[model samples]
Target: MELPHSTAPAADRPSVAHHRPGRARRTRPDHAAPRARRPLSAKVRRYLWYTAAAVGIYGASLAYAHLEEASHQAVQATNAAH
Candidate 1:
């Protein structure tokens, strides 16, 4: 009986890495330090924070107005039925 020929050497299996079979390349290359970021001016920072607070307060007031209107409508509906 003739033996079948295998395509790859047993160690260089498709499931394994092209490098060492079990061991990974341990150490990563040290990257360059990140570029320093410019800090925002105090005026710009204060303006942005104030703008955010204004938007948040406006949104809350709008939501409260809608809830208040809905409650008033419900009260009117009950009054009409009585």
Candidate 2:
């Protein structure tokens, strides 16, 4: 629908940058910025942290299981002796 006092048509809008004929239009190439590279030491440090975390979790779970088994075996041994 056409609004009141709006003389210009919607299709005739000039909402874009106008490049002059004599000037070069600005352009961006695909590889304007090089891919960021993580330092070798930083990568190694990250893997080490991950390895440490996994090992810590595994060790904690193993210790818990061992403790539980030992307590159960001790209870059984005492019951058998009595």
- Per-model lDDT: 0.84, 0.84
lDDT of 1 by residue, 1-82 (tens): 6455565567665664557744475644655766679999999999999999999999999999999999999999999999
The whole-model C-alpha lDDT of candidate 1 against the native structure comes to 0.84
Score candidate 2 by lDDT: 0.84
Could you tell me the lDDT of residue 9 within candidate 1? 62
What TM-scores do the predictions have?
Answer: 0.52, 0.44
lDDT of 2 by residue, 37-81 (tens): 966798889999999999999999999999999999999999999
What's the CA error at residue 61 for candidate 1, in Å?
Answer: 1.4
